[model samples]
Target: MNSKDLKILNLFKFDENLLISYSINLLKIIIILILIKIIISIGSSVIQRFFNKQKQSKFGFNEKKADTLSELLKSILRYVMYFIGIMWILEVLGLSIKTVIAVTSVAGVAVGLGAQNFIKDVISGFFILFEDQFAVGDYVEIDGLSGFVETVGLRVTKLRDFSGDLHIIPNGSIVRVTNKSRGNMRALVDITISYEEDIDKAINIIKDVNEKMKKEFKEIIEGPNVLGVTNFSDYGATIRVVAKTEAMKQWGVEMELRKRIKHALDENHIALPIPKRIIMNYKKGETNGN
Candidate 1:
């Protein structure tokens, strides 16, 4: 071998001490990884138990709120533990913690300037949770998208619509939220009766149906009484019935009310409106034709 090649070979020679040092560091890294996983699992379980306890307490913390807090806490904990584990691993691999932090600080300044939206999303998410604007399982409309909230994470919120489509929305973009599941909702139904039928008789029939429904459906909170003749169209006169129902139960109640109203009208011999048309016939020698 030439002199230059011999010198380069000597520089990279694998000595016993160097091999031992690398194997020790590798073993330490494996141990650190295993420990991180174990700790994270245990921490997650603890967080869940804490929330479950809160849910079972009589202090007025509902299941939905408890679930939301649990998920958020677990997420935060997992990320923190992973970050710590990575920093420790780097230190074990001969990089000092202070040096690593100094380098990251310089990079973080540049990243922070470019990631304003990310910061805004995280801040907005914190406010959403703290303010109790909406929780998981709540039917809400945000930025014109209506759905049941599935998750409220630091960066994004998940919504599942009636059609089973999942929407992932960034938290910063959710400036306004309309929550429909917060209180009672109104269930409205309109029925049309023929003008020829007695309006008084139709009203009585609807009242009877409403009385029976009030007893059957406990979700109905207020009257399903007919509001008299609301409008007159070419087809018929419209009668409106409205009821207050528990949140998320309005649609079911409205459907049931319509079905029962139809049956009641049929039983009482009240005729429902049907469209009709009149036709005029012209002879061959009509005035305009002639």
Candidate 2:
């Protein structure tokens, strides 16, 4: 072959080798991804099984607590596996993990300064997990945002309020947390009755309803004491009933109590608040209408 043809042939071989190398790296990437998926699945299953065994064993973990911890562990496991798998794939593609880490370490100094909030979030996440301040599925109020805890990640905590708005809060910003699903919660129901009705009769009727509700709802933990005539509002006399219930059951108990009380008041002929109008049209010192 001539010199020009020889050069063309050598270039073709070089391109061929490069294509083969890239193809092999692509295959390795696919394999690494599959392995990561398998590992994550197995890890999650193991974590779930461990927590389930704890529930069945003498471990102090209740079912909800077990489930909560299991999910958090699975989250951590997935993140770790994905990170390792990514580094492995990068190495397969001829990017040395050590070199990448070394460069990242140098760049990290600058990145870390700007990412102080990120570091804080991760540190706060560890404290949150260790201290057992709250868990997944707990209804908590964090930083004025109240909702059921959805996902507690190392960087963020998610909350979906009743209006269906998702709030993604950085863990570092969480200063105070009001976990409503921890201990017994208070169920308070305020009912308004007419001023003309006999206050004592209404009070007795409400007390009887409360006693019946205590039997009906096993969620009730303590007395639903009736605080008679708690307020005299524009609506009427507001009677308050307060009870202690199983955590997260307070709202349900309050709703049921309100509904039953409403029906009971109706059955007992207790007059509820009614709007009265006295229209006086004085023409030459005479009242015309009521």
Candidate 3:
């Protein structure tokens, strides 16, 4: 009787119903994983298309903002897909979701504390994007580092300077930003002449040249006004020339203005100041008198 009962107990323990449930759960998990992959693929494609279309529209849309939104959408989609996939997998394995969530909450708090800087960077980056501080391809000075913005990520900003130097900066550390590409830039030039030269004539020549230059270079927004007698220094009387030019055109305009002024002075016979010294010739036989 004891041997028969033991054999029956072993058969019951290896029941067919248990095998069927296990196989069904395994199939369900596999199907869920496949479904998750399909959803992720389709969702990513849709997001990419929508954003790409937005970028191409003639709505005066900002390229950087479109790129940022696209990236954020992709990141969120990936995370959500994986999270649901994992939960479904756990459910198939007969695990309690409530316990998993409790543990994840504890771990999340710890992670939040450990990743405070990352969180701050993300928050600051959002603010920067929303505030329109700067964008890709814009020349800006941030935290004393000046460069063209290469990329604007959630945590860091990438910049490429004129010298080909690349700078990676945390968003939270960027306290102040100076965007040089936003508005008109000022062009300044200073000219000097000898004290012996006629000041009135020099100013007149300068004003004449500026008038002609304004007509020549349409980039000059306002008069390259010759502010006469700006300073009377030891070297000479400093005359100032100032003009406003379009952004990124200031440098070229300034250089051209300087060249024009130099050429004008030469043509007008304006004298440049020189350091002077006096020397006395001594007789060959003369000696020092004591």
Top model by TM-score, which number?
2
- Report the Cα lDDT for candidate 3: 0.83
Per-residue alpha-carbon lDDT of candidate 3 for residues 1-290, written as tens digits (9 for 90 to 100): 69999999888888877898899998999999899999989998998788788889988356766766665566568778998999989878887899789878889888986578888987998888788888777789998999988777777888899899999999988998999978888889888888988989988988988899899988888888886788887768888989888777888988888888788888989977765644544766555432
Give the per-residue lDDT digits (tens) of candidate 1, residues 73-177. 876787788899999999998889899999888998889855888889889989999999999889999999999988888778999999999999999989889
RMSD for all candidates, in order, please: 4.5, 2.4, 8.3
RMSD of 1: 4.5
For candidate 2, write residues 106-208 as lDDT tens digits.
9988888657987898899888878988887889999899998887777778888999999999889999999889889999999999988998999999999
Clashes of 2: 0
Query: In each prediction, how many residue pairs overlap at the backbone (N, C-alpha, C within less than 3 A)?
Result: 0, 0, 0
- lDDT-best of 1 and 3: 1
Ranking by TM-score: 2, 1, 3
Off by over 4 Å in 2: 277-290
How do these models rank on lDDT, best leading?
1, 2, 3
Residue pairs in clash, model 1? none
Clashing pairs in 2: none
List candidate 1 stretches off by more than 4 Å.
Answer: 1-38, 274-290
